[model samples]
Target: MTRRTENLAGRALMAAFCLAVLVPFAGIVLAALHPPGSVVPGLSWPQHPTLESFTRAWSDAGFGGLLRNSAVIALGVVPLALVCASLAGYAFATMTFRGRKVLFGFLMLGLALPYEAAVVPLYYDLRAIGLTDTPLALILALTGLFMPFGAFWMREQFLALPKEMTEAASIDGAGSWTVLWRVLLPCSRPALITLGLLYFLWAWNQFLLSLILIQNPAGRTAPAGLGFFVGAHNIDVPLLSAATLIVIGPVVAVYLFFQRHFIAGMLAGAVKG
Candidate 1:
């Protein structure tokens, strides 16, 4: 095809994809703007759109507590996961040790394992340890569950760096920790930011683990709380839509805030690979 033809085709394809995503989202927004308990059929615009559904949903769903719980879990998971992933990635990428390959291979097995298959066993195990029904249980589980991918991503990023950077740091009398914290980390900001965003998003949106592990309504994550809210308000489309938007608001805000770095990190990884 000619260059102009290819450009036009690509633009058209992009627009199609954008509409595919935005159309459903726009429908939800419109539905939410209708009065609470109103039947919003097929994305019809409300004649008198109001934010009443949002307020009612927030109060009815106890979203303040739900969002707080989600934040707490996400905050707990992100730092712990990042620390473990970075350390493991650094060791795997830059160090030589026995059983390294075996260890990495074993860790990678987690990527292939279905988390659902382990949920029942995990519940029993955590119950035995008196950790079930607590935020800590979910936090720890999410951190561990995220480790395999986190480590793999960090390892690729570290491996793509020039060996001379580490060598120079070593010659400058920098220890492993110093080289990691001071030298390498500064260069890996995009990767770290991207990974942290992913961790936060996953932790915030983790419904199954939150639902299964945390029984206390007071400690339920936003997504888990939303599930209950959905069940209770199944017939209220506007209120349900409003509640759904509230649950996902933080994730959308975070992505928008870090859009540049996330895109850069993804592009960097793609080029390196």
Candidate 2:
């Protein structure tokens, strides 16, 4: 077959795959707008569209409070995670210290540890400390949970930088913190933003953690809020669909806004020699 034919076939396959993934979501959107008690026909638009479901779902599920809590937790976790990860990663990548390799190896173990394994222990620990059912618990847990990957990502970014940059800064009397904050960090914007966005997404969508850690429904994140919504509206497909869409809207908006930078950041380390 000619190259043109092969390219067309590949394109067709990709389009089909995308459609397959999107078709159900499209149905959900239509179903959300469908009249109460009406059956949603497969792959068809709503016959009697109404805005009531969105409003009803939003108020009844307490999404406003959920969104607020999720945002606060994400905002709390992302910066702390990024800063700690970046600093630790820089040290691991550049500095020689006693037990550095061992410490880093321990952090790396976090990457392989399942959240389920840690949740029970974390719950009891936090409860003992009187932090369970609080936003702080989620923030701290997520930051710790994210540390392994975050540190590794930043370490890769730091390692990719030329050694001469650090040498030059040192020769000019720049200290370690200054070199990191003023010089290296400015150049690491893409990687930093990518890391921060990833952390934000993880913290926002965190379900099991939010569900198990916070007993107060008001402190739950969107995904966790949707869990309650699911139980309350189990048989009401339209309401359930509306709640699901509401929960996903913020994540979708965030991706759309930072798509270009996100793409670049993801590919930044791919070509390193």
Which candidate leads the pack in TM-score? 1
Candidate 1's residue-wise lDDT over 1-273, tens digit each? 999999999999999999999999999999999999888878788999999999999999999999998998899999999999999999999999999999999999999999999999999999999998788999899999999999999999999988899999999999999999998778888999999999999999999988899898888999999999999999999999999999989999999999999999999899986
Minimal lDDT window, size 10, model 1? 36-45
Q: 36-134, model 2: which lDDT tens digit per residue? A: 556766667776789788999988988998888888998999999999999888999989999999999999998887879989999999999999989
Score each candidate by Cα lDDT.
0.93, 0.89
lDDT for position 55 in model 1: 98
> What's the CA error at residue 17 for candidate 2, in Å?
3.7
Structural similarity to truth (TM-score) of each candidate: 0.97, 0.94
User: By TM-score, how accurate is candidate 1?
Assistant: 0.97
Whole-model lDDT, candidate 1?
Answer: 0.93
